[model samples]
Target: MAQTKNLEVWLRGPLPDMPPLLQPIAHALLQAREEVQSFMQDFPEELIWERPAGVASVGYHLQHLAGILDRLFTYARGEALTDEQLASLYAEGKPVEAADQVSALMQQYEQRVDRALEQLRQTDENTLTETRRVGRAQVESTVHGLLFHAAEHTMRHVGQLLVTARILREKTQA
Candidate 1:
């Protein structure tokens, strides 16, 4: 009896404008973005930067999520990080005291995710295997690798951010 092999691994498709090979990457990035938005609804802004038990703060995760996508996509394009990007990386973990900082960070994260999706849409599947250099050290990786890592890393940080936000909210009420 011929049976269909595990279909879940090959089911990437249907995301508007995403390349056939890049659909999974786009889907993953969008899923991560939705998770962040869902978990952060009405999250108290005052605790965005409050690290619980020496872990990273929610604010740091938010900033790094955006910055990671931007940097990795830039690498995928075979370009060096610009001076502004370098400065953004330098600022990732620094806390801000501004009242609207959480909203600002959320906006930045969402914008980065949108940009990543657009890049995925425009990518040619033929170039997925082409080598790309990462960072000034010229670390070698393929276009596919960089795009996959961008989605993976964004979800990783979103998980951490959600945990941190929950902990901060719980602590505030205790």
Candidate 2:
């Protein structure tokens, strides 16, 4: 078992290139990533798609985490989802033969986070209040709203993943 470290990503200080107002957003994202990575270390692949207590499986949460971040970041850029993005969104929870491993999913999520952080770096704090549209419904929101949502949503899924992962581990141990 790996020894638990400080757990809080914010204690490392603000991310470079992230705007002041967006520091919390970056902190939340980094925190989620750190927790997810640690919690997933050495996790069994066989249980990735196992649903415990009728809740979503760990695989779904991992895939959704990456997909949601990609979609939210795309919206934050005042852009629409491309066909590829739409396909990815539609396929979030379902398992695929390839790319089903925990490491692959984690790599995808880490890459998405990198992209989101890059977007945050380029975001003009002054424009955070500017209106942005979301999804095919084109719901109204602001840049700040989207960014904050990305962090909170990521954390929410992280929480679910943690619980599910723990349950799976306990079952295996038993």
Candidate 3:
């Protein structure tokens, strides 16, 4: 029932444990999370993996959202992806026999966001400009760049999920 009509996450006020400089990053992420969660509240389970217009499924979006956040946060910490993390990346979007329901996926996303926020809180604003490498490609980026990308990437996928879910819902109703 929470609507993002008049208010945004930033307008909601400052987040506890978040650095002033990183406030915008946290706001954008929390806003995307809220909108995704609200829009998915009544989404049909049967359509979780349905792909309309040949787009990626709702399940994929949910999983990718959580996975990407974790990976980006890891890079921000200056750590390479562990073997487990690599395996997770490979398994994303692949169907699972006992795949989690939308609620479970949402729970996982919430926990990951909590972890990301904690990391943000502990981040040193002075180091925001320090260079960081991403993945095996060693793509160069700054601490601030990675953090900003996390929020930006999340919002992008949230938009995708919203469109895909709406399409599936329309199909079901028709």
Candidate 2 residue pairs that clash: none
The candidate, 1 or 2, that scores higher on lDDT is 2
How far off is model 3, as Cα RMSD?
2.7
Q: What lDDT tens digits, residue by residue, belong to model 2 across residues 118-137? A: 88999999999999999778
Worst 10 residues of 1 by lDDT: 1-10
The list of candidate 1 runs beyond 4 A from truth reads 1-13, 96-98
TM-score of model 3 vs. true structure: 0.92
What's the distance in Å from true for residue 116, model 2?
Answer: 0.6
Q: What is the descending TM-score order?
A: 2, 3, 1
Among these predictions, the greatest TM-score belongs to: 2
Local distance difference test, each candidate: 0.87, 0.90, 0.88
Give TM per candidate. 0.90, 0.94, 0.92
- Residue 98 of model 1 has an lDDT of 64
RMSD of model 2, in Å? 3.2
Backbone clash count for every predicted candidate, in the order shown: 0, 0, 0
What digit string (tens of lDDT, one per residue) describes model 3 on residues 1-174? Answer: 556467888887788878999999989888888899888998888888888878999889988888889999999999999998898789877755555588777877788888888889999999999999998889999999999999899999999999999889888999
